[model samples]
Target chain A: MGCEEFELLLNGYIDGELKDPDLKRVEKHLAGCPPCQKLVRDYQRLKEVTAEMKFKNPPQEIWDSYWQRVFHRITRGVGWVFFLVGAVAVAGFAVYEFATDPAVEALQKLIVFAIFVGLGLLLISVIWERVKASKTDKYKEIER
Target chain B: MSLTEKEIVSKCQRGETEYYEQLVNKYKRSAYFYALGMVGSVEDALDLSQEAFIRAYRSIKRFKPQYQFKNWFFRILTNLCISHLRKKRRRRVEVSTEDKEGRTMPLPDDHFNPHLLLERKEIMRQLWKALSELGNKHREIILLRDFQGLSYKQIYEILEIPVGTVMSRLHQARSRLRVKMADFM
Candidate 1:
């Protein structure tokens, strides 16, 4: 096998993910190639050292209350959605009333109407752009 | 009989809200630790994992029975961490690892020491610092392969990539790490 082919198999060989024929080919290449042998050795040591490095355990209290926190978050998430929708609806109604009120100057009413329309369009455009990007982003599934 | 993960998900989609907790409890540790490895803080990890769970629960109906729920949930958690990292970097906020009294120490990128279990303290410290410095892709694959001990196939499932991609990515990650640790070697 070429050096490039052997290089591709090196990780799988070290990871024990290479199949028999490929593994034997890599082994034979390693026997004849000093550079490949050194690469494997280095990777093996790197793996051992990294394997030993572990994140410290957080306090047990975190785990104890984890579920509770998640529960509260889920509830609050629903609450926030309703709160936002209500807030937006109320604000939109207020703007609409101001725009239609007879006492308002024509320029002022037009400005309010323009601002509301601009914000609504902006929101839709942003959401549509996001949806389109998500469809095209190959890593979308990785992010779920 | 106890329900499988897929079965629990099916029940969750059917409006059995209580069954969702089973899914949470099943994968919470992995989810939290995975986020912790990515973000390098306990608080962010906790918050992001919980947030991911909420997102997953909200989208449970969209889940396919053919896929493993853990992988699906993990993907959500990973994306949340990536998004969190991007926002934190944009804001230039160090990870808040402060005491209640507000005393803080300066370190690289608000790093938390992961040398608690390693025999080689200096090496582990350098290893972690190098890991924190690596880009998101390299750091992620290193965490999955070396730290989490996930097989290539499992990494493939989580990454939604071909097995060859996993192998190549892992090799590149390890190579970058080796370069980063040249001083130690």
Candidate 2:
């Protein structure tokens, strides 16, 4: 292998990562090249030295508490949001289908009215909650 | 199919949520260390890794089993830590608490006497600093190849990069570290 190629692949060879053709070239080059041989040895020595450094694992509770707050609660809220949206979408589709169909006019009006009432109540609750939340935000965020 | 980690991951696609604890436990140490290596503190590493795991767990439902879970989760952890570090730097109110001895000493000298153990600790600290100073890509590749002991293909899979990229990055990372060995160890 050329000195350039050997330099490129030297680390891999030390890690026993060099494949056949490249490995062959490196071996052939090492047989004649003292600098290349020293380079390989030094690479190995450095790797061994650094390998002694150990990466530390984080403690267990931080992961547990952090995720629960960041993701668990967030997902739980988002899950409800998704369900509400899906329920609304499907209900709207059904009501439209029932109303627009000649054979289902009775079913359509009843379902549509039910959806309207339910949606109205839900919107009122959501609006009230949001207003309350905004009032809290005004209080809490104002401090910042 | 190379019977990729994707296969195991796909199995986790839904019911996978229940089994996620397995994946978390498996990656917990290495993932934590990788984060620790960058953030430079046990506390930050712990916080970051935990956060990383939670993010991974939250998105477990969307994880495709046909893909390798190793890379999938690691990418999330890597992204979370990097982003957290960026935001953290922005909120940089905490002036560094200087090591009390660092002010008067060179910081690496444990003693004037010949103690191999002290020397080894100094070496490890140096290496840790060297690894931390590497650019993010080099740091990730070294963690994957050396610390995590991933094969070339697996590193590529984890990185979602070409094999050539993995090889070159690995080379770059090692060369950078090799040059910094004195500073590191």
Candidate 3:
């Protein structure tokens, strides 16, 4: 191949991506061409520079943001769960305040607190259910 | 280098925004480097990356679910880089057969000391001076194939051109780069 032809195929040949016939032809030409040989060598070296170039990782927070973004998305789903539980708990508190007097039992406050804890756990469970409910592939197809 | 192309597209089309970020973060460095390499500015790289992501997000709807995600992402990035380069109207010197000696590839400047980093930063000032100095067609082909590691077929796919065009452009691009880097050799 002359300098012009060799110049056109030099890169493809260096990358080992030329068609078979084209490859052999380029190889045959390179066997006797000084400029083409030099061209091939230079392309190889430049490819090396590219290959050797360092791979820099993005910042750690980017990864964190990846999961955090996912988690935050889940959090919004959980928010409704919390809202429901908080509402029930508030209602229970209001009922207790208006219904029997506080002096009814020594353990009354403790029982009420325990009920609130249960209510909170129920809220979390509900959130988990909602997340599980939407975990289907069909819903996964939906974007925010 | 990434999830199989189909899987990526399906995941994205399925409204997998977070899954798409994997694509972003995966190629972020290359996208960033290409932008930085071509535009010779970090600000441009940042802008280009954002633009690439936004563009990718918007047009992803048109992407066939059967295509490769990396290739598709690269298509967006390279085009953005090209467009970004065009809008700014920069020039790259045609790399010709020149004395390409002693252009030692230092460890990438990411590891340099603050002072060296400054020097390295300035290095970009003249670095793209070589590549940027090339003609427009030569510039795009070279940057896409060499710096971007795109296959001829992939280049054709991305650019929507014939494979023959990819090969010729690649050859010209590499020749030009060799000429530009000739001084360093």
Top TM-score model: 1
Q: 1 or 3: which has the higher TM-score?
A: 1
| RMSD, every candidate, angstroms | 9.4, 10.0, 16.2
How far out, in Å, is residue B112 in model 1?
4.4
Off by over 4 Å in 2: A55-144, B1-11, B88-120, B183-185
Model 1: per-residue lDDT, tens digit, B82-176?
88888766444343346678876333455455543334488888887788888887888888888878888778887888999998888888888
Local distance difference test values of all predictions, in order: 0.82, 0.67, 0.65
Candidate 1 steric clashes = 0
Model 3 lDDT tens row, B1-185: 66765677678777776676666667666676666655656556666765776677667778876567667777787788778666443212121133469443322222112221123333333335555567766766666676777788877877788987888877767667667777654
Q: Considering lDDT, where higher is better, how would the candidates rank from best to worst?
A: 1, 2, 3
Q: Write candidate 1's Cα lDDT for A12-121 as tens digits.
A: 99999999898888888999999889888889989998888777777799888888888888888789999999999998899778867899899988786798789989
Q: What is the interface RMSD of candidate 1, in Å?
A: 6.5
Pitting candidate 2 against candidate 3, the one with the higher DockQ is 2
Clashes of each: 0, 5, 16
Q: For candidate 2, lDDT tens digit of each residue in B6-67?
A: 54455555554544555665676777667766666666676777677776666777877665
* Candidate 3 vs. true structure, TM-score: 0.59
Question: For model 1, what is the alpha-carbon lDDT of residue B107?
Answer: 32
